[model samples]
Target chain A: MKAITLNSFGGPDAFELRDVPRPAPGAGQVLVRVHATSINPLDYQVRRGDYRDHVPLPAITGHDVSGVVEEVGAGVTAFVPGDEVWYTPRIFDGPGSYAEYHVADESIVGKKPASLSHLEAASLTLVGGTAWEALAVRAQLRAGESILIHGGAGGVGHVAIQVAKAIGARVFTTARSEQFEFVRGLGADVVIDYRNEDHVEVVMRETAGEGVDVIFDTIGGDTLSRAPDVLAQLGRVVTIVDTAQPQNLVQAWGKNASYHFVFTRQNRGKLDELGALVERGQLRPHVGATYSLADIPLAHARLESRDSGLRGKIAIAVVPPAHADARQPRA
Target chain B: MKAITLNSFGGPDAFELRDVPRPAPGAGQVLVRVHATSINPLDYQVRRGDYRDHVPLPAITGHDVSGVVEEVGAGVTAFVPGDEVWYTPRIFDGPGSYAEYHVADESIVGKKPASLSHLEAASLTLVGGTAWEALAVRAQLRAGESILIHGGAGGVGHVAIQVAKAIGARVFTTARSEQFEFVRGLGADVVIDYRNEDHVEVVMRETAGEGVDVIFDTIGGDTLSRAPDVLAQLGRVVTIVDTAQPQNLVQAWGKNASYHFVFTRQNRGKLDELGALVERGQLRPHVGATYSLADIPLAHARLESRDSGLRGKIAIAVVPPAHADARQPRA
Candidate 1:
């Protein structure tokens, strides 16, 4: 079984394609014939030694997996051989889904959405679950409320916009001027060109100075610190970014603001919720690029570059599904 | 009418004892002949110009009020003249409760608990409301959950301990060695000597390394930065202190922690909840010291001094209630 293994943590070049032994299903687990996986910021962060202590040397480190169950271990009742399944592997646990085959506990796996191809399912698994946890579980964003989503064209942000819209929330999103129409097409009621406009002024003016009820921050840096300026009283700010610098948050006190810092542990519940949306044609991942298993390092480099022009996720075709040519630069 | 006025922002002496014009009630307002008021950290913060922009010069800056209604303006129907009432004046609105007479909107006032004296009721108003908001509203602390309250012997923390206990939560509190029995008496299940003991180690050991479900931080500084170390997954950290310095909170991401920065806004609902707790004997404010209206400068200096050994709130007797001799060193 060919897998991309990391012997050391550094740049994208550190990922080496090697023939590794395929893992068998343990008790309560199911062996999956890997069909696809995707690139997320967490992958780049892990590859750069950001979480060096958690992932040791000689690690198989991909997270998302969209595949078919090859075998089920003893005590497993949810899945059987040849069933299509999709889920994020338990992060930082044992071997990951970078290989030709992978195994996960039955409880964490979900039936893949029938409407999506394996490439699309892999792309949405991690980012979709993350957006679900941050918005639905943590922030509890409700209908008719307004939410400001920072970096609305990115992987998690794109899913978050759709999720908020699905929950009947009015979405205000930020992107570059070039992506304004792209995000608007995804149900963003208001879109701000983040690089060319002041987001605080746009949101405050749009909301009549009351500010939005929630803020989904996929961009780190000053977003967390400036959240209070555009947040309504008793509003929530949910951020997936783990920034290195300390932030000044004294202003948040006046608004009685709640800040949720999410690293999204894996579970089937959120995956099922996302799949329901996908099945209903209300949610889909925009696969900005596709790569072969051996081209993971290239995908990593492309995603890391500032001018990559990646709008959503980069899917890696471990075993390319049919209709592979349907892949596009955006979606 | 005599009042303590802040003509400028500086040290204790910034407050000047002066004869000022008494206030009259406007529409939807009530004129309160303030019987007693209490000192909170907000008072010192306002005096030192922490909120200088919100509070103008020559401002009367006390918050908690316990008194008799002297008059009611048009559309004010909550109470009549001579009715006993307790509430925090709408913060930073008109004049605060630092003078002989104060005016407040009828909607923000609550009836004084029949079991408490004016000094006792005054001592509990702002701090009690703050603790209720933090523990009940923001944190949503539940039965069987564990909470860590920093500075459990201080003004807000004292009330927070009682509130957590009233909600059936297990309370783990940090205080000086001298105040262990004090906090324990207030229903704390575990008391850590914050100076001599490592609170993180104590909490981890007690909860079997799972950490506390909620952390009420009245002591600022590194508490917010280090909270992730002792917080359970999905735990809530509610802080009333607005520190001047920025904090490192990157560690909070992995725990899915929610941080609530609270500078409590005035409301009648929270005050009524606290009143119910008081009537049921589930909560009470410990008044550490008392001062006459003319001795406010001394009171301010005493509350500010580290060696003053104040355990809870310092009550100012504008028109001292009968049985003034009941004031004690500890209570």
Candidate 2:
């Protein structure tokens, strides 16, 4: 099987496309023939040895995939051959979904959404899981409350806007002026241009000086620091980005806000819930740009230089069934 | 009426006895003829003006009181003259309960526990409320879970021992060697001497390396910083003392702990629930010592000296009930 393996951690150029021996499934595991895989910021971090001590070496890059069942190991009764499934591999443990075929525990993987195509299914796994965990699981967002969602146009932010609205929460977003209409189209109640005006002032003034009930910050640093100032009494704030300093404790004591740092773990139950929403047309994935698997270097370069125009996830297309058999992605 | 007042912020000798004008109750208020008021660490902090920004000057020192209702104001229906009540007044917004007659909103006071006398009722208000809020409200301690409570001989810890047992949670406590029997008698499953042995090590060894589900710290400083080390996965740690530095970010995030700092406030619902428990013989107050109303300086002196034998609350008794008259506490 052909796979992208990192011999040493350094840069994007360190990933080598090479031939490797195929892995087989053990008990309670299923072999998946991956059709498509998506990219995430964590993938780049893991590739560069940022989490080297915790995660094992010579790792694969992709964490999420839309794949088909190829084989079932001993005691695996949940899945069968040719069953279409979408999943994220075990967090920092099992081999990732970047290769042609991978084996995973059936308990941590879910059936793919029936409505969306293969690429769309792959795109929804990482960002959708993270956004849902932050808003629903961590914050416990209530209906009829208000939320200030920072980075509302990015991959996770764009999906979060829809999810928060689905849960009946009014959304206040921060982004560039040029993308305000796009963000509003995704159901944001109010949009603040971060470049032109202060987001804290806008949020405070808009919520009648009481601040929002929750703040979801996909962008950390300054945005996370100001989360408490705009938090209502007994409100909560959640951030996905790592803190600026490892020891600088974030205090929201005066406002009675609980600050949570979310590193989204893959939950099969949560993924199944997201799949139901996607099937019902209440949730959808936005793939901003797509490239062939061979053009992964270009995709990585474009993603490293992020800007306002980036609407959703950047994906690596696995030939779309055109160049089959020559180098089958499901090999 | 004669009372002890704080003329300035310095040390224990700053309190002075004086004769002041009596106060009358306003609408929806009750005038209580205070029989006894208990001393708390908060009262000492308020006298030193440490919390001056939150609480103004010229304020009374006490927060916990139990007495007979002398008068009822307009629209006050639940309480009337000759009724017995127990209360902890809101510290900053209202007056303290350390005088001949004190005014409190009807929502903040509750009926006294019929099983105990006035001195016992007064001592139960502060420590009881703190323990209930930390264990029941914040931690939501499950039936089979375990807890590690520090300062088991102090006012808060003594009350917490009974409350944790009442909730069906196993408790491990740390106290002075002399107070070990007292804490164990209050239903502590394991007692460690905080003087010589390390509490965290004892808890770990007892539980076979699995830490407790909740940790209650009445004495902060290094205890708050090291509390996360003794917490199970997804455990909670709540503290009442603010003297600890905020350098425990790593362990807190590592174990995914929910940290809370408790400053017990007057909640009628919570106070009433605790009052019922005391009335039912499920909980009891342990009065460590008693002092006359004129010995306010001596009470403060004893607290500062950290009298080794002190096991519970020290209450100030009203001087010669026949000579006492209705007078509002200084705000």
Candidate 3:
């Protein structure tokens, strides 16, 4: 089987494409023939040795997978051969989804949404679960409340907007002027051009100074520290980005604010919820770029670049589908 | 009317004993002839200019009040003259409760518990509301869960222990070895001497490495930053103490932890809930020291000192009760 292995953590060029032995399913596990996987912030972070202690040398590291079950291990009752599945691999566990074939425990995998293609399902799996957990499970964002999603055109932020809207919440998103139309089309009731406008002032003014009920922070720097300025009484701030610098949060005391720091763990429950939304047409993943399995290093470079003009996830086709769906990205 | 006024932010001696004009009740208000007031951490924080921007100079800055209504203004039907009452003054909105008379909206006042004296009731008001808000409202601490309350012998922590016990939670408190029996009597199931023991190690050992479900942090410095080390997977950390410096919270991301920063606001609902607990003998306030109206400077000095041997609140007798109850502090 062909796989991308990281012998050392440094830059995009560190990922080497080579032939590796295919893994067999253990008990309660299913062997999957990988069709697609996608790039997330965690990918770049891991490739740059941000989590060096967790991933050892010569690791096949990837997170999201949209694949078909090729074989089932002994005691695996949930899945059989040829069933399409989508899931985020258990973080920091054994091998991941960067190879031609992947094996996972049956409990963590979910039936892929019928409406999405392999690339689309792969793009949504990791980011979809993160956005769902941050908004629904942690923040408990309710109906009729207003939510502010920072960097609303990015992978997690884009899905967060849809999830918040699906929960009947009014969405306020921040994006560059060029991406405003893209986010606004995804059910954002109010869109602030972050580079050209002050988001706090715009949100406060738009909501009559009451501020938003919740803030979903996908952008790392200073967002956690400044969340209190635009939060309503008892408002919640959920951040998926782990910041390196310390943050001063004295102002949050006055608002009785809650901050949820999320590094989402893999589970079938959240994936099922996201799939329900996808099936109902309330959610969709926008794949901004596509790459072949060997071109993962190129995808990493594009996603990591500051001026890449990327609006959504970068999908990697491990084994391309026979035909492309309307929602699939153009390679 | 005699009152202790903070003309400037500084040490204890900055307070001036002066005769000021007594406040009158306006529409929807009650004029309270203050029998007692108590010192809260907020008092010292306000005096030290930690919140100088919110508090103006020459302000009367006490928070807890236990007294009798001297008059009621138009549309105020909650109380009549001579009715005993207890409440925390609406924070930063008007003159506080340090003076001979205090005026407050009728909606924020509650009937004093018949079992307590003026000093005892005054000692509990501010701290009780704060503890209730942190545990019951913010953390939503449930029955059969575990909690770690830091500084369990201090003002807010003392009441928090009783509240957690009342909510059927197993309480783990940190205190001096000498105060172990004190916190135990207040229903703490486990007590850790924070001075000598590594709280993280003790908590991990006791809970079998599944840390406490909730942590109530009254002693703040680095507690917020280190909370993740001893928290369960989705545990909550609620802090009342505001740190001046920034905190490194990178470790909190993997735990899916929630941090609630609380500066409690005044409300009658919380007071009523506390009143019910007091009526049922499930809660009691411990008055560690007492001072007369003219001795506020000394009281502040004692409360702020590290070696004062303080156990609970310092009650100020603005107008001492005619007879002392067993729960009342001895002057």
Best by lDDT: 3
Q: How large an RMSD does model 3 have?
A: 2.4
As for candidate 2, its clashing pairs are none
- Per-residue lDDT tens digits for candidate 3, residues A228-321, read 9999999999999985578887888878899998987879999999999999999999988889999999999888885437878889989865
Local error of candidate 2 at residue A92 (angstroms)? 2.0
Kindly report the docking quality category of candidate 1: medium
**Backbone clashes in model 3, listed as residue pairs:** none
**Model 1 bad stretches (over 4 Å):** A323-331, B323-330
Give model 3's docking category. medium
List, residue by residue over A95-140, the lDDT tens digit for candidate 1: 8878899989999999998778888899998999999999999899
What proportion of the true contacts does each candidate reproduce?
0.82, 0.09, 0.85
RMSD of 2: 4.4
Give the alpha carbon lDDT tens digit for every residue of A91-121 in model 2. Answer: 7786787778888998987898877666777
Better of 1 and 3 by DockQ: 3
| lDDT tens digits by residue: candidate 2, B90-152 | 867766766777888888889987777677778889889989988998777879899999888
